[model samples]
Target: MNTPLRRLATITLVMFVALMGSATWVQFFQAESLNTDGRNVRTLYREHGNARGPIVAGGEAIATSVPVDDPFGYQRTYSQGDLYSAVTGFYSIANSRSQLELAENDQLTGRSDQLFFTRIRDLLTGKRPEGAAVETTILPAAQQAARNGLGAQHGAVVALEPATGRILALVSTPGFDPNVLAVHSTSEAAAQYRALDQADGNPLRPNTHQERYAPGSTFKLVTAAAALESGDYQADTPVPSPDQLTLPQTSATIGNFGGGSCGGEQVSLADALRTSCNTAFASLGMTLGEDVLREQSERFGFLDPDLAVPMPVVESVFPSDLDQAVLAQSAIGQRDVQASPLQMAMVASAIANGGRLMTPYLVETVRAADLTIVSQTDPEPYSDAVSSATASALTQMMVGVVDSGTGKAARIAGVQVAGKTGTAQTVEGQPPHAWFTAFAPADAPRVAVAVIVENGGNLGNEATGGAVAAPIARAVIEAVLAS
Candidate 1:
């Protein structure tokens, strides 16, 4: 062969090798990054191309996929629509996601490493690449109870097992049907979501853990726990009713819930918590000091976004200054302190479980359609927030609240439903939102619940958490207990 021809052949081979390297980089290494990019138009197309999985509850497909005629015509169809919107969330090509769909996409879509076993099986079975169906911890009865109990007012209900962190029902009022958002091509339907999102009141929160509110008197549980753990106060510790808590650092005073002082010069901590007395709580907070308060809050899963599920939680905002007044107001659940329904549920659960905070879990297990358990969430004890002794002390005080205090409306016949009530402050002209957190069967708590109602049922500032929120919690607890 001529020298020129040999040299030409060598150069051609080198160029070919470089081209193959570039192609491999783009296809193998860069494909996943490009596909998952937020702006990738082809992402939804690929999601549609895969054999999407079913959303099952009670062995029925509450949600599935069906084919249509648009460019990316296939879509997810929900049988129950609004009934499961907050849980299933909508998977729309036009609008990306919500609920479990947005958070658990990789798992449900079979793109996770955890899906390897199922992926291998599909390959051998000649089945198209598909994800395993998801099973929830929800009971249909519990879910219905949440929706029915809330009625026209906006609120949220979250119930979970005290022994186990399995979430039974999580419902937010004024929920949108997921079916509407699943149909991407229909402009009318998309417009409806926008309207709902921009509604006079926000319908998007689906409260669970996504929204924040002053826990009101419901936060007394934490203060009560802190007070008991401090050793400075026992259940019967004498907390004075000065009518106003004077700030130790600054000349400011914190008043009681309705500006009334505790009738007796000093009341027991048990009596104070049962009455949800603002003055007593402020005094207790001052006595406990700031570090103890902050430690207890952190132990209760404050600042941890994954306190339960992957939902958002407003951490307990501890005052930076240990100002006697700030501590007092915070103890009463006011002046910049906030929490979500989910967070309060954890508090109730910790109290119910003898001071152990179990990480809240929404999914019971991830199983294939054939009932094979592909993955399951082990009931994990997230943190030891307090001691069993503290739990007992708090439980007794909570029971008193339901039996003889502000939470009288939540009383159940023959069943011990320990609870706390909070009538929180709202804007000047607005009635406060009612708040309640509880766990039933004082001796052996099975369910922990947190409920909140917006604008005090439109009752013109007459609303108390016991009157508006506790009843809803009672009904939900009854439903779960019955199950």
Candidate 2:
């Protein structure tokens, strides 16, 4: 080869080697991500070809892959449609798969690691087998009750079995119907899915566990825990002031919900929680200091990165370097402290279950088409996040809040209800959102609930959680308890 010819040949070889190396890296290393990407047509082809399993609740098919006389053979159909859209989510050839549908994709389709042994057993018996089904912990009655209670209201209600952490109902208003995107053809499904994905309402958020909200006074549960754990406050421990104390690091003054001073120039811990007194609790927060309060909050799993929920779950925030003023504000559940309904439910569950917060679960078990149990979850205790004594004391305090204080509307007839009510200030001028959390028959404590009603505009700023959100929470608890 001459000078020019040799140079061209060497250059060509180098370029060819580099191209091959790049192809190898992506085709092998990045293949899983690329193929699983919602836009991967090949993955859609595979999903449609297989007889994907059904997602059932209350003995009814909420989600299934229906066969269509098309080239790919089938499409995912949602029977409950919009009612359970947030839970089952949408598996569209047009849009991406998400929520429980995507998280449990392997299990729902009966190709999970646990299904291998069952498959072998079927082969040994010389019988062809269908994929498995996913039975969620949801109770239809409670789900309907929540839907009815929140009718025409733009908020969410979540109820869980406190002992087992099995979510009975997860409801978010203004949801979308999944049927519109369950197209048999890949291209059509993809197109339909993108429309919803691009829409402004953000219908995909299963608000109970996914979206973060100002926890409001429901967060007082955590503050109470911090108080007890610090050894500073007990059921009868007294707070020292009735006046709103000016925040140390800022110009803000923390006062009671209605700006009423805590009665009698001071109040006992029980009385403070019962009245939902902002001043008294602000003093408690300052006394506990950042270290004690933040430590207790973290122990409650507020900052967990890998939350146990299937879809995204937002972690509760508690600033580490909290100033005296910041501590006071956080104690009243404001500014940068955000949490989901699931988190509040967990807090209530922790108190109900003697300070042990079990990880919340939606799907209780996965079974074969023949009704064989493939997998299940025990009522496993996550952590000894609080002392048993502390839980008992907190339970009593919450019960007091409901019986005669702010959460009175949450009382269920014949049930010993324990609850906390909140009317959290959202903005300087806007009406605060109403929040209520409760668990009933306090002794056995079966169900726990957390509910939020946005704006409370019609009801006006005077809408405490008792008058607004508590009734809804009560209805859900009654429905579940009746069962």
Estimate every model's Cα lDDT from 0 to 1. Answer: 0.80, 0.81
lDDT of 1 by residue, 246-303 (tens): 7777778777767876667689989998888887887777778778887888788766
For model 2 the TM-score comes to 0.91
Steric overlap count per candidate: 0, 3
Give me the candidate number with maximum lDDT.
2
Cα RMSD of predicted structure 2: 2.8
lDDT of 1 at 253: 75
Q: For candidate 2, write residues 1-483 as lDDT tens digits.
A: 499999999999999999999999999999978867878878777777877788888878899877788886767788767778768888777676777888888787666778998778878997655568988889988988988887766678888888888989888765678888776655776677677667654677767777777777777788889888877678898886566788886777877766676687778888888988888877888887878767777777788778865666778777778778888878878877787778887888888888888888888778887788988877777677799999999999999999988888888778989999887778778788888998887998989888887767248677778899999999999998889
TM-score of 1: 0.90
